[model samples]
Target chain A: MSGLQPCEILVVDDNPGDVRLIQESLKDGRVPNRIHAARDGEEALAFLRRQAPFESAPRPDLILLDLNMPKVGGLEVLRAIKASPEWKTIPTVILTTSMGNGDIKGCYEAQANAYLVKPTDLGTFSEMLSSIQSFWLTLATLPVG
Target chain B: MTQTPAPAISPITLHLLLGDLPGLATCLLGGGGQVLEWTEGAHALLGQGREEAVGRPIADLLRIPAESPLPLLGQRAETWSLLTRRDGSTFRAQLITLPVPEGHLLLMHPALGTPQPKEETVRELMELRQALDESAIVAITDAKGDITYANDRFCRISQYSREELLGKNHRIINSGYHPKAFFTNLWSSIARGHVWRGEIKNRAKDGSYYWVDTTIVPFLDASGRPWQYMSIRFEITERKRVEEALLEKQAELEERAAALARSNADLEQFAYVASHDLQEPLRMVSSFTELLAKRYKGRLDTDADEFIDFAMQGALRMQVMIQDLLAYARLSNTMEGTQRIHLEDALDAALANLSLAVKEAAPTIRRFPLPVVMGDLSHLTLLYQNLLANALKFRHPGRPLELTLGAEREGGHWRCSVKDNGIGFDPQYAERIFTIFQRLHSRAEYPGNGIGLAFCKKIVERHGGRIWVESTPNQGTTFLFTLPMDRSPS
Candidate 1:
């Protein structure tokens, strides 16, 4: 096997408060990576599709998504990205404010990589973020694109 | 006794001795009962006032006259004779002869009404008779039950003429609707001089049957012995007819209401059985597929192995979705199990189960004062599992996530919220996500069965509560649901 590039992560969300918290919580990762940001699912999908605005976008090894969004929701973006052959292989984690059974069931049916109910408390949110970072970066064997 | 007989007491002097008599008339009868001088009082008292009394013999004056009381007096002259005045008034008079002179003096005593008038008394009696005629029915009988009088109302109701019914026995109008004993008892009471009140069925003179409620009273003489019986009656046919109709309608309504309740119970039972039966096969499919993946991991080609993994994952997801559906169907049953549960402990257990995942995700989990709730524990546990696991599962590649859980009391319930900062979804898609198998992502992007929120919905409903969500893409997400916080028994 030839040597591969390091796995990259893409985060699609509009809230700066959430962006700050996620950035702060994911500290204990053992992977060689760069964390990128997209304001919405549409932007995230555009990045993955190698569109004009995202022409120099690097292929994301993993994606962390929000189900709710302006223009393109996390579920729609996930569906669009997963249906495209070029970006279908990337793992996506759905982080959303919905705890309803229907929301969870629908996310899985639409082929989300993972579904998570977002925690509001700063302490719980940090722990949850750190754990996710640890699991995906240290234990997970994500493909280097 | 003090005066000597003088002037031989002429006829005029004798008339003066009987001064101011109401019908005083002097009559002088010569020897051999021949009339000589007869006083006017004599003729005025008898209506033998025919002036023929002046010269007639005494025997002729005592003869019966067609237009006078003379006829009655003539029959029984010595004891008492009736004298009729011009106004149809009568008086009782007795004659005594003076032995030496062979003359007569009449002493008169009249019953008060005889010389007065019968005009007012006759008028009052006539009015009473008219009132009786207009009443429902009135009949009078002697103590022996033979008819003596019947008012017009009675005659009309019975279709009988007064001539035919005046002396007839009461049995002549018997309808025979009542047994013989009923009549015997009624007669027995009346014979004992007691009033008898009852409903009687009678046959009319024209052979028609009619019913009347009657009250019969016995009239008594001075010695309190029964002399006559009077009966008044009324008809009651319409009242009886209405009572019968009402009784029938009430019975029919009671029967219809019972049947409707039975049908409603049956429909409820059908829904419970249908959803329960459908869940069994889905569970079997998922468990076996999971087994195949665990057992045969490395024995297949890459594409084949991947396909199997995808198939098993899909089956597991389907199983979760079906279970959520079953939970929804059984909500009515779960409501019965509502009880107080320790939220602190429930949260600890949820964290414990996801401990490995929590450390792996490294999310900042903060919990505030959580309220205990009235809920089904097993269902609540399932709901908590999905929510906690969800918090840890969705994390951006580099950014940290913050989660806070809190509660507020409102409307007799605690509205609990779980907040998280990750890749939050948009507000518009919030309503669409909480349905069974309603996924918002593709298989390659996320790995989940997508039934967690549906389970939360079922649990909230079981507690007689509601759940909803609010979020903005790239912003934070918040989930809210309500539950009774103090459903403890007193």
Candidate 2:
């Protein structure tokens, strides 16, 4: 058996259904990965900074962020992530229900690694999450945390 | 009257007779009609004594008739004559003749009254010529239009010398601006003995152009044909230039006004496209619902599954509403395509589109006679569909749903009404109910995004019309709108 370490992914979304969907999609994905969840942008940033409750949490190799959330929306979190020297290397992908051109360009301008719109159909949404896992976590190599 | 001969007087007899007469004026003439031997009364009457008069001729003292022959010395003669004084006054007299020692001695006596006519016509003609030369550009052309006479003003304005201009046809100064027909008309007018007056643009010897207000008067001969033409001209080049500039400015202002209208139309198109871009986010939400329902269908518990089902339904409803809004925003883009539309046809289309909803509500639609109106064809269909759908959607729960669709002519437009016997809204919220996203009822009571009536209002207003509502708490609701009968641009 190949003894590669399991990839760590942090999913940030305000909707509990969307966060649960991401977790289910990754659990059924072909890659060996561990999925973490944050209910809002504030919690996602806290985990990324390893502060307090997140001190014992493993450093995530990837982040899937929603544009809209309860506090500290995706653009502010993306900016905070890229601005810090510690967490700047993590690949942050934007996944949201908004396919607006302004939102897409705003994320890219704020140094988001990639932008993707969440699919509405359950089958397509699972396929997209699996593809994200296969491409970012399974194939790509990451720096030591 | 013929001259009659007078009685003769002898000179020796006259000297013997007049020597004794003190008042007798006598002159001893030399061979060539000179005078001599003046008497004292003669010197006083003639104002010339013997010293001044002795060597002078007798003819100088008299106004002699040219036809009368002077008699020789010692000849008998009688004729009427005049004697002039040195003070320039003259008196009529009778001539007396006699023979003398050397020349004829003559006597004169006052006869009667007559006046001499003085000549002043030649001087008056000179003053008239000077006045014409100073004021007007005078030119005389012969019957064949050749230059005969041109005054100083004409020469100065034409920049041509008199020697160079004379005998030349009027064509030498033609600027070639006027067509042949223009000159032909002028010739025809002048040929019929009428004075031809017009403004002529003429070229000078220096190749510069000038405009002249001209009047050509034709002089006729005894045979009634024109013998010559006299032209009087005044300069009007400066006035013509100002008029041309004003016309150019007027044309420029019209062009600018047309450009401004085009720019306003472009801005309206931009607004329409920008609203169309909002559809993307609604589609994204719809897609998300489909994904959530498919992924978590049987895996989630009953409550979670039901909640997901509700979210999917809401997303699908929102998607439909946004499509309607997109169609509404695009109305201005097709405003140019609006034409005369029949209200009956619009209502038919609306009924077709809402047949499913109509079947579910089981509403009784009673349509009265409708009229034709002017509006965009597709938009008119959408307008009717929205109103009709609202009528069926908001029906009362207990009683069977009923709808009354009718139209009538109101002044210059067709006023249409869609009334429903539904759970009618309050009269206070009538205006607010038509606003987008402003619902009077919650989702449990009525499932809608509240955009239907707003679309109806926009469509009516864009067609140069109006839309309004009348309703009570539970009796019914009537949505009335107007559409212009005549084809008019929004």
DockQ top scorer: 2
lDDT of 2 by residue, B1-490 (tens): 9975643765545654664465456666677876655665567556777687767666665545453434544775666555667665565566777666556767766653222322254346457767867787889998889998999888998999999899899999999999999999999988877899999999999999999999999987545788689998888889878878999999999999899768856755664455455444555565566666776788989998898888878777765665566666566666665676778898899889988998899888798998767778778888999988888888888899988989888887888899998888889998897777789989887887888888788788888889999998789999999888855543
Per-candidate interface DockQ score: 0.01, 0.13
Q: List runs of model 2 lying over 4 Å from the truth.
A: A1-145, B1-325, B334-336, B486-490
Model 1 residue B231 CA deviation (Å) reads: 36
Provide the lDDT at B356 for model 2.
95
DockQ of 1: 0.01
Per-residue lDDT of model 1, residues B1-490, tens digit only: 5985655766456655663466444455555555555555565555565466556665555642332332122222433344445445454444433322444433333433245336687578678867766876888898888998887777877899988888899778998889999989998888778999998888899998777889999987545667789888776545544665787787778777677656744544664465455444443454445445655778777887798778776665654554555556555455556678878776777788788988888888888998778776767776777777766666566688788988899988899888887677878878777876666777578777666786687677657789999887776778898888786764
Tens digit of per-residue lDDT, candidate 1, span A1-145: 1125454778888765566556655544444556778889778877887786989999886788987788888889888877888778787888876666888998899898789866533456657766676676666776655
The residue pairs found clashing in candidate 2 are A120-B287, A120-B288, A120-B290, A120-B291, A121-B290, A121-B291, A122-B290, A122-B291
Docking quality level of the chain pair in candidate 1 = incorrect
Query: Distance (Å) between predicted and true CA of A133, model 2?
Result: 17
